[model samples]
Target: MASAITTLAADAPTLSAANTGFMLICSALVMLMTPGLAFFYGGMVRVKSSLNMLMMSFISLGIVTILWVLYGFSLAFGTDSGSLIGWNSDYVGLSGIGITELWDGYTIPVYVFAVFQLMFAVITPALISGALADRVKFGAWVLFTALWVTVVYFPVAHWVWGAGGWLFELGVIDFAGGTAVHINAGAAALGVILVIGKRVGFKKDPMRPHSLPLVMLGAGLLWFGWFGFNAGSWLGNDDGVGAVMFVNTQVATAAAMLAWLGYEKLRHGSFTTLGAASGAVAGLVAITPSGGAVSPLGAIAVGVIAGVLCAMAVGLKYKFGYDDSLDVIGVHLVGGVVGSLLVGLFATGGVQSDVAGLFYGGGLEQLGKQAIGVFAVLAYSLVASALLAFLLDKTIGMRVSEDDEVAGIDQVEHAETAYDFSGAGGGAASRSTAAPAPSAASKKVDA
Candidate 1:
């Protein structure tokens, strides 16, 4: 370790062992959120399409990882390009990211930063898949993922976070990713849902989750991974801000879960596991931007408001006639907006950024800035995603055939099934129906 630091002496970048190590671990933690989301979304889907739901999320890690290394990172974080995007092509494929070169303010090597950011890039698109669940062709979906990131995510990331970016200059208080991650994906999900239309049965059939256990498990994993997701945005462990964020993340999630259960009991006369898990996620999303900025009390306030808003927002699909299968728009989009907007009201000075919010005597200026950031990203993402999905649907086709839809997407798309949701083994399969039995002659052969 000593020799490694000494070797880079000529660079004079002043590497910090603690920050470098913390960021790498944080990156890994963020990466886990994608698969965790798969289990979460998979559980929400019908058993027949559960595996396909899982695969939709899993594929993002594979596709986005490669793209980020190739040119995605360059276009995102490279030199300013008219304040709209980046253009230091030299950083493409990490070409100009020297071994000893440090990030602008931090001590970690730029490559470390790149890898960390790659995880964020990978997961953002995966968040969109749950809205389009069970109907998209895997190939078309893959193509959409690639194009959407290139067109929508990359440029918006530049606008929001890249050097000389407009939002950063305007002082948007994202803290983590209320705008760039949650709102962006949430609005994109809405746009695509408008284009794709509804699931086969829509309001007619009961689309209850196949596995509440998986939903709880996924929610548990998201709660765990979010520690890294929120605190790690500080870019180092040297500050107490990370500790504050850690506690805030926990408190807000707990508050939201409680609030959701209470709301469910009032509205439906019973608390539900699905409501608990979804509420926890809504809380996590709400705190992503505000946790670092708000007090623990503030976090609870944000949590309660987000819990109620998102809990109600999920019902919009029915009223407006959009088929957001797993409530990505409701939870992520609504939660993100709740968190971002509240930051302007809750952010007290003396925290990480030292920016006072409205309640702190900073007036409504900061809150207004937060609103601009939120709506700007929201509008751009919605338009771009709708156009992209519409084009894809028109050309190569987006939704599967009605035949494939009723039979199950896993069987139609992957030629595999999640499990015997049907009673295939004569054991009363899962929740749906019985799988077809083998021919009478080939019935286990008495083996």
Candidate 2:
């Protein structure tokens, strides 16, 4: 009977080349999100460091991509090792695994999956840098990403996605990385913020976004790319499930956008562009965990709730004095937790039999399980992240000098300015003019 079942499972039609082709396209779509994130973050920072902020995310594409191809994939999803890490035997340096090797009953290629997953690995750590923008050394960030991916991200990824992962064994259904991506990155963001300290001026400066249009553009790209993110989690273009997830993704984001704007208008007397962008992200984050599990109505609820909650949570940085510059904690960490927890209550019977929420008559048992999962991931992520930051700080130093910061990281660290309007070859005037004034209020004001 066991062999018969195995035979049935194996005989199931693998994802066709066309399906794999779609997934590969989806992966590329997801890769675009990092640059979208760069724009999103770049526009929000003071102009002095806008280019630097953008560079942070772009650098991850280079650094993490190389690392993933080398050994990152091995540590993340190669094979199970005691439920903690993955073994190096399979797919090391892309060895032995060929286009024929089946992944999730897909005949496409394992390498395709590896490359797709690599994009995700590249972007997750980049998401955290928003909280510590304009302060840390570029060199230090390079080192931090290199170390963080190896120590923090890869292990958590293994635990959630690997064959023998603890979370996988425990029946924790993440659907698309509520715990691994958002929560993990959010927790790490909190740690880095604690270690790196606040931006130079922080609260007193009214550091409004330099380019609202850029933020909106980034948000738009992220929304477009996220279809791949949530839908592709199914690992194949099998049925209507992908289409369902895609639609939910759109609805939830729109609902959250409205919810956030409404909340902001109620509290602050005006709805800023920043609020709109942040709300869209909050919706996206909230729906990530529950998108595949819930119905369309549930997606709307999750999105709206996450939007309002995260919109309010952004103020917590000022009230509590944590200095999460762009509200990584407010949007990702808090949004992720809210969505993850809510799925326990709103998940319908269509997603899974073992999973049902409070409203679905599953009672508090599932909620308790969700709470436990949330706390466990939060606690583990927080401690692990702090230690990683501390160790990196002690070893390679985590911050740049005040002089370098005031001068701007683009010229100081990378020896290149994002723009060259004057076309001068590295002159003093060029350097001086390249750096925007430190006072965020003095820059361009939008009507």
Candidate 3:
């Protein structure tokens, strides 16, 4: 996401303590999203697999952070190498950068920028884990996280945001990460799931979420952190673009939540807590890329469209026979595409830049550029991710044995359960426990 400061960086930029402090806080907020995502995905799985699901997301925090400090920041934002990747001797291991050195023309230190972007890197691969939940081996997921970020995420980040990268140079308007983060993760999810196959039971099992309250809590945390994720992409609040993005993020999220609940009521005969949580996330995804450029009215339109489309898309897994366990493909892939493309239609030219979208009389050029960015990221991530999963499946194995899966992946993989029910079991603990409570049947019999 290029800003006016980025363009004018050649003017010998000075440090702005205010912007630096703002970005550090934003980085912290983004970091919280990984655990929030864990709770969100964890709650959606069966009780048998809840801990495993949470671990899938939480692992990325440990894995990606170490990798980011090493070469990830360099490959993503270092000097461009042939418009496909990046490299800089100064960025290896983050060793050469001084504490006070600002990032190019921006006021924030390079360290601040690196850490903020590091949060995005950590969460992107974690997103894929949701689609593969309840079946994949923990070791395989960890390996996949390390390899996928090395290959897919780093290069894709460069393409979308790095200086002189193809999409960035081509003027793709991914203000935050519709293409780089959401679409990239969503498409990779589809690819890996296709290779790894569905969960143990595809359609026959009930497989309902173990906890709705956990999902709601996670969704609430994500909503709170996203203000930083979106607004901070501008790098500074020197201009009001960051403020506009902040407003649009709220507007689109609210609209999407309402739209999703409305659709659920009509289509399923009830408004569910799951629907509310999922709809809010869909809106957040849709607004990520276009929030800075679109008006509040445009954000509403984008939210409504994304909420409805994603709500419908989640059902496609059943009809198409792909078991996206947690609707990652539906909410993220479809929502990312919707938000990225709408930028071409809803851009007001009054924000970000003087580039108007179709409705604002800028015609279809921006739309075409957006389509190119969207499809390019989708195609690459899908193919590469599938190949990675296939190799892992053929080698060390990606899925657990059917016996282990049925018995509960959490117990097999983590050697622990989310809750302890031994006290209720008919064993020594149960014998020792006092059970004076009586049911209506016992009361009637006693009477």
Highest-lDDT candidate = 3
Model 3 steric clash pairs: none
TM-score of 1: 0.92
What tens digits encode model 1's per-residue C-alpha lDDT throughout 316-372? 999988999999999999999999999999998778788888888889998999999
**Model 1: residues with Cα > 4 Å off, grouped in runs:** 1-13, 420-447
Q: Model 2 over residues 1-447: C-alpha lDDT tens digits?
A: 999999998888664788778889989989999999999998898777788899899999999988887788888887788988897666677776766777755566788888888988988998999998878888888888888898888888888778888877776767777888899899989988787777776778778887889999999999888888888877776667777788888999999999999998999899888888999999888888788878999999999899999998999999888989888999999998999899888988685344778898778776776677677777887887888778878888887778887787677777877666665577787777776555655544521
Q: Rate the local accuracy (lDDT) of all candidates.
A: 0.91, 0.84, 0.95
- TM of each candidate vs. truth: 0.92, 0.90, 0.93
Off by over 4 Å in 3: 1-11, 424-447
Clashing pairs in 1: 421-430, 422-433, 423-429, 423-434
Measured over all alpha carbons after superposition, the RMSD of each candidate to the real structure, in angstroms, is 4.8, 7.1, 6.2
For candidate 1, the per-residue lDDT at 247 reads 92
Residue 444 accuracy (lDDT) in model 2: 42
